[model samples]
Target: MKSILTKPSSRIYGATRQAPGSKSISNRILLLSSLTPTKTQLKDLLNSEDTNIMINATYAFGARVQRSQPEWSIHKLTLLTSKHSELFLGNSGTSARSLSAMLSCYQGNYFLYGLQRIHERPLQDMLFSLRTIGTNIKHLFRPSCLPLFIRPLATVKDSIRVLLDGSTSSQYITALLMVLPMYKRKLGKGITLLIHSIVTSKPYVTMTLLLLERLGMIVHRYGWKLFSTCIIANRYTGPSFCIEMDISSASYYLILGLVNRSNLKLLSICLYNVQGDFFLVCILKRMGCSILVSRSDVSIYKQARKLLPLRIACHSIPDVSMVLLIVTLITACSISLSGIRSWRLKETDRLLAMTMELRKLGVVVECGIDFISAYSLPTSHLNKDSTININTYGDHRIAMCFAVISSQGVNVRIMNHQCINKTFPSFYYVFNSLAG
Candidate 1:
């Protein structure tokens, strides 16, 4: 479903509604659910591409995932009588890495594999730590990458410390913590997972802790980046839990306020969001877009200013690079963004994707290997309205971000809308609600 863009009115209004479930929380809970003896009923699991991958992977790992109408059930791995499992994590980094680290403790051979994207993603950090604890895990392909075969370790009698960046992806640290309790510490205490770098995207860690608590695991949160967890046997029980809204996916609509459309009050987003993408909402609004944030929703209305030029560091909010890059195209002038070196690791190199997509729009976007500067030239469309043909490089964010770029009175066609199935399946419909 390619989006046809047109300039929006000041009032892009709609009844505020709840978006889908948080991908981060859903994946983490699914991993934990498979490990605990509790019958976990996960509600509001995202009907997105990533979560669907997780759902299939849960069943592949030999867990009885009961699905009724909308919700799902993951019978605890502890309660399961089976000892053999081969897991297939489609392309989910969180699910693959977390499951790999946790399967190490089960003391059996469980092969975890995934698609090309997962094969391309880094798992060396997780492998190094797990191997330190005596897990017989090794990559089937090149070292530090995926297609890994896991053989059960004899026994882990030692605990280890791992230092990694929270900015890269909090899943690395959280993976260790989720499987940490099964390790042997020096004094017979629970496994100690320490983050040695200044953490970015701290909200994701918070989300992890929240789900851990819901599962009844005792996790102690010390400063911003520090957290410790121990295995409390019989903690995870199969019960209903609500998945939080996805602020990351919602940012596409939130950026509509920049188009000077409507003064909407009740947008379909929440205020206290644990997702890091929420900060982009505040940041875009701060740059002069009229944004109203409520307890369970956020409303985006246009501002008097045509557009505001912004310079933001994207190291912490790496996922928002698509939205931010789209904004750069709509600006009356150039905007500079820094700290984007991590784009190389995504399904596609997002940094390059943004540049290539911007070029399609006839914008002169100069991008170094680490940073990008895009200047929205005074185009005929800004004055006379032109149509935009958006080419999505099979990247979901590309498809989603182009929807935002389409709001400028230009009929935008996003080729390969199916690419959005990578993250948000409903992206076409949800984005159309805002595009209208």
Candidate 2:
């Protein structure tokens, strides 16, 4: 459906839902496994548009993939021909950035293009680092944008080093890191990465480092800024791996329960995940939501009479901040989230999209490059009787977060509702189930 209308509810109660696998871990593992000569079987990989893009890209790069429900076998071909190839990555930033770096290592003519919005996202910072290592790239349309041709030179450096500005996006750092073993094998030594400025998403980079460590690669660091991997494994060789549940997706339901004062239980909740968005639980607790966490389940219900006004930095939990912003509207409480400049670089310009939409709901919204604050406006400025139509701007998180308004006695119409396919394809099914 292009649009979905959710009817208002008095309250929601007694519901349970299973969280999806982590998209970050799933994509990283998909690429890492395809680089290994050994066969790697991944269990519980997220079945979504973003992961499917990675899967198709791996197959296009000559990796053999066998699909079995809940398990996928990926075997890297002994030889990947340096033939001409064209890859079309949807608006998945993870796929576009990481695949660009990985394809740069191969001596081939590869054409890369994506959807319209993806073309607007920044690729210049990552391309500059790749070009420093002698990777040939031609930007087709705009500078620092997508629709490009990449051809690596037919030479291998004996030793290599490059500098990256850490504040750009953690995905750029992760893109280079994931392709390090290939450089290590070709160069006969580990490549050194000199990072300048503060890393924007340190937790995500930590996730990359942890995954590299899982592949038995030894990354040595001088203090926190400089990183280099030991030439231990020329290729990854993990036989089988399980992906952790996505805490980002879980935040939607948890916040839904808090807004509706409902009894909701989330299944397969992992407390020890490397995903930084797990901090949502702590944020909810701080907001006075009654939450109970156990080995594999989390329960949320009514406890607090009201959600407290929150002022918090969103650098570590950028993905779920959309739902937190929605909480500001549902509870009619003030919320100010900072350190989210990266949102401007996501699938859509989230900072601008959010500000515009919040204003439509009679919220007094204020925003800059790095922060957004919202509070309910005066009663005279409110439109209390009409349904709110939320334009999602094709951002999956925006569509999902606005769906929660139904529980707050507001009818909500979500435009481009199918955009949730980018991450959680079954979101509406689950949301409707919980709404029953």
Candidate 3:
């Protein structure tokens, strides 16, 4: 259903709600489970399009997957036995990139394709790295983009090494990291990776490594330049695993409390979580939002005065930048955000998307290669219409961030509102519950 959210006449009081499991953790665990030769049970698995694709991809590789709400059972494939298969990943970069690397290291003939937007996303760095390790994979359409075909390698290499461009998506590195363990199991030697430049989204790579350690794998990092993994048990041993609540999804509600000056609580979300987006709370506090952290939940209460404008770099917290930008818009303050070069590679070109959309609301936004400065306009000059339409460009964050604007009493009509189903299917429901 299309959502046209209008601000409530009454103030939003304090409310508590639970977010879905972290998509990042759910997908990573799904990939790791497929490489094992035992039955694994995953609890609190995210039931979204992105993660469903990962589950189906694992099933195609001959693993058995069964779901019973909040829990899933995966039976490992005895061998990389799928001789031929076709996978259609719908705009899930995590599933496409990670599954491609896993399929390459196995004995199979596979075709990996995705939605048009996914094909536009870059995969060259990961593909090049896999090719260096002797995987017989080729890009069917563009050099770095998708529509890939993989043929079985005649012989698996004993060890692998490749240089990656770190400026692009960190998923490339994650894909490589997830697949290397398989090589170790087959050839009895580990793999080495050299990153040629400064890695953007370093926190995501750290998250990947932390998950690997939990599954009983060891990865060594020498500064940001190189990563090497030694042979451990190549397979993940799991009777059960639980995923954390999505910190990225929780940021929206936290911002709501900050903007409305009402008390907001996020259920089952912890402040000391592995998810990098958890740092958003610190950024919020720095901007003069009152926050309280406890063992059970995190709460944000609105401030009496206008929020302090911020000038910060957001390379590690890229996902939260859009929400922060929206904060700048509502308060009409000059905010400068830098270290966001990777925004261009997301589901849409977010920098361009934000600038174009904000201009429609009479906000002066300047975009650079790695920075954005938003100069707030006076309320008199701003469009005072009760209703405004926003184009979402099929990016979930764009859709959700703008939805928060509606809570301030403006009517916001979000075009392509279904894009939020990719990660947070219940976004609108949860948003309404809080705003009411």
Which residue runs does candidate 2 get wrong by more than 4 Å?
Answer: 154-159, 377-385
lDDT of 2 by residue, 1-436 (tens): 4898875665776887888899999999998887777888888889999999998888756687788887888988856744688889999999999999998888788988989999999888888888878788888999968898888665556667878887879999999988877777776666888898788878898899888888878677676589887856555676688888888888889997777666899988857778888888888888888888888888987576777889999887788877888877777779999999999999899999999998888778999989999998433344547778999999999998888777766778999898999999998878777665
lDDT of 3 by residue, 1-436 (tens): 4755544423577888888899999999888887667888998899998888888888766687898875888887656546899999999988888988888877778999989999999888788888888889888988867899988865656556778998777888888888887777766766788999888888899999988887778889899899988645646676578888898888888888877767888877776677888888888888888888887698888778777889988988888878888877677777889999888888999999999998888788999999999976543354446568899999999999988876766677898899999999999877877666
Q: Pick the candidate with the highest lDDT.
A: 2
What 10-residue stretch in candidate 2 is worst by lDDT? 377-386
Q: Compared with the true structure, what per-residue lDDT tens digits does model 1 show for residues 55-92?
A: 66666445767777677777845343446666667767
Query: Looking at candidate 3, what is the lDDT of residue 118?
Result: 91
Error of 3 at 130 (Å): 1.0
- In candidate 1, stretches whose alpha carbon ends up further than 4 angstroms from where it belongs are 1-18, 60-62, 77-83, 163-167, 184-189, 221-227, 231-234, 263-268, 382-389, 434-436
All candidates' lDDT scores?
Answer: 0.67, 0.83, 0.82
Model 2's TM-score against the true structure: 0.95
Off by over 4 Å in 3: 1-10, 154-159, 378-385
lDDT pick, better of 1 and 2: 2
| RMSD of model 1 against the true structure | 3.4
